[model samples]
Target: MPVVTYTLWRLSLFAVTLVVLVWVGMGSWLAIVLAAVIAWALSYVLLGRQRDAAALHLAQRAKPGRSAPADAEVEDAALDAAERERGAA
Candidate 1:
């Protein structure tokens, strides 16, 4: 859930920044661009912990030797059975 939390936080920051910029008489396009940059900068500085947690979570999920999904396991079993049958025949 760290990834989800981090994503929500970033999106919330961007939305608030956009609203504030638009309220200050900035054009919509300019406000969007500036808000995105501002939000990214602010999050990078202020949300370091959350960013690290999210990164760690992603890294763990992508690490080698993780368990295969059930579908993959089942597929492997089927392939093994087919190969054994072919060998026996």
Candidate 2:
């Protein structure tokens, strides 16, 4: 699953767990705090590997000097020209 979908799933699970805890009379404020901590810990433990993989994928995709085709150079020149025109105007 995508990182976003995984995250949302975890969040919804956390919410349901917290609601159940509160419904069981675990004290509203304490349940909220404990649930947040537990959710964060569980998320870190369970999703750490996937998060690391996503980070690595992004890092590889962003490897230097590998982006865009030669057309990017033309785009840059056009942008520079537009900037110069704006300054002159």
Error of 1 at 72 (Å): 12
State each model's CA lDDT, in order.
0.94, 0.79
lDDT of 2 by residue, 1-89 (tens): 45566678578768977998898889888999888888888878888776776677778767655675466677899999999999999
Q: Point out where model 2 deviates above 4 Å.
A: 60-79, 83-89
Q: Pick the candidate with the highest TM-score.
A: 1
Candidate no. 2 TM-score? 0.57
- The stretch of ten residues in a row with the least summed lDDT in candidate 1 is 63-72
- Give model 1's TM-score versus the native structure: 0.76
Per-model TM-score, in order, reads 0.76, 0.57
Tens-digit lDDT track of model 1 for 1-89 = 99999999999999999999999999999999999999999999999999999999999988655865666678899999999999999
